[model samples]
Target: MKGKNALEMCARAEYGEMRGKNAFEMCAEAGYGEMKGKNALEMCAGAGYGEMKGKNAFEMCAGAGYGGMRGKNAFEMCARAE
Candidate 1:
C-alpha cells in the first residue's frame, strides 16, 4: 500500500512538472493543461470543444467531452483531451 501511494504521488509530481506547471496550476479549478482559462459553460458545452482543445482537465471539464468532457476539467470547461 505504501509503495502504491508513493508511486501515485510520484506520478502526480512528475505530471505537474511535465509542462513547467506547479501543483496549483496543474490542479487549477478551471483546469491547468490546455483549457488554461475558459470561464463559461461553452467550454464544456457541446462536443469536442474543451477537452479535445486544452492540455489537461480543460480537456475533460470545459472542452474534453460532449456535451464535451480532463483529459477537460470541472463543470465549465469539461470538454477537452489533455
Candidate 2:
C-alpha cells in the first residue's frame, strides 16, 4: 500500500475510537509492519502487537544496516544499547 494510505489507516486505528476485533484486524491489515520511516515505527508501536513490534524492530535494524536512519535508528540504538 501507499505510504499515505498506510498512515491514514494507522491514524484511524489510533484515533478513530474503533476497538476490539475490527480495530485489531484493521491494524493488522494496514500492513503497519511493512511500512517505512517514522510512520512505520509509530504505527507498529501503537498497534500493541508483540509480533508486529518485533517485526518493526527487525525492519529498523535492517534499515540501519542499509545506512538509512529513517525510523530504524532509534529502535536499533535502543535495542542494542539495552
Candidate 3:
C-alpha cells in the first residue's frame, strides 16, 4: 500500500510537471477528484460539475458510471450536494 501510494504520488507529480498550468487549471475547475480519490459528493460540489449543461451532464454521468461512480442517484445527489 505504501509503495502504491508512493507510485501514485510520483505519477501525480509527473502529471503536474508535464501538464503544468493546464492540468492545475482543469483540476481546480473540475475538482481534485479528477486527480485524486475525492468522493462523489466532493466532486459534485465543484465548479466544473455545476457549469456543465444538460448534454454534458448526461455524458459525465455516463462516464462516471463506467468509471465506478455507480447508482442512479449518484449524479443527482452529487449535483444537489454541491
Candidate 4:
C-alpha cells in the first residue's frame, strides 16, 4: 500500500506454486500432502531426488514458481519470469 509496489514483494515470496510442486505441497507436506509424509517426496513425485532429466520434475516442491493448484525453487530464480 505504498509507492514501492508492495504486491511485487509478495509475488517474490517463495509460496504457492513458485516451484514445480502442488500449491499445497510445501505447506501441506508438513503434515499431509500424502499420508506418508516421510520426506519432501511425499509432497510430490520426485522420482527419488526431486528431479529428473536434469530438469526438475513436475511434482517437485523445488523448481519454478508459477501456476496455481500446481506446484519453490533455487534454480528457477535464474529463470525468466513467465
Candidate lDDT scores, in order, read 0.35, 0.40, 0.35, 0.36
Cα misplacement distance, residue 4 of candidate 4 (Å): 21
- Give Cα distance to truth, residue 62, candidate 4, Å: 7.8
Residue 35 in candidate 2, Cα distance off native in Å? 17
Q: Show model 3 residue runs off by greater than 4 Å.
A: 1-35, 50-82
TM-score of model 3 vs. true structure: 0.20
- Kindly report the root-mean-square deviation of model 1 from the true structure over all alpha carbons: 9.8
Q: Candidate 1 regions off by >4 Å? A: 1-11, 16-24, 27-34, 38-82
Cα-based lDDT at residue 25, candidate 4: 45
Listed in order, each prediction's TM-score against the native is 0.19, 0.20, 0.20, 0.23
Write the residue-wise lDDT of candidate 4 on 24-82 in tens digits.
34333444324334433333443334343134334342443446312334223223233
User: Across residues 1-82, which tens digit of lDDT does each residue of candidate 1 receive?
Assistant: 1222222332345453434443334443335345455433333332244334433433343333344331233423311212
Candidate 3 per-residue C-alpha lDDT over 17-81 given as tens digits, one digit per residue, 9 for 90 to 100? 33333323433343344534333334334325433322232354544543333432333423332
Order the candidate numbers by lDDT, best to worst. Answer: 2, 4, 3, 1
Which of the numbered candidates is closest to the native, going by highest lDDT?
Answer: 2
> Predictions ranked by TM-score, top down?
4, 3, 2, 1
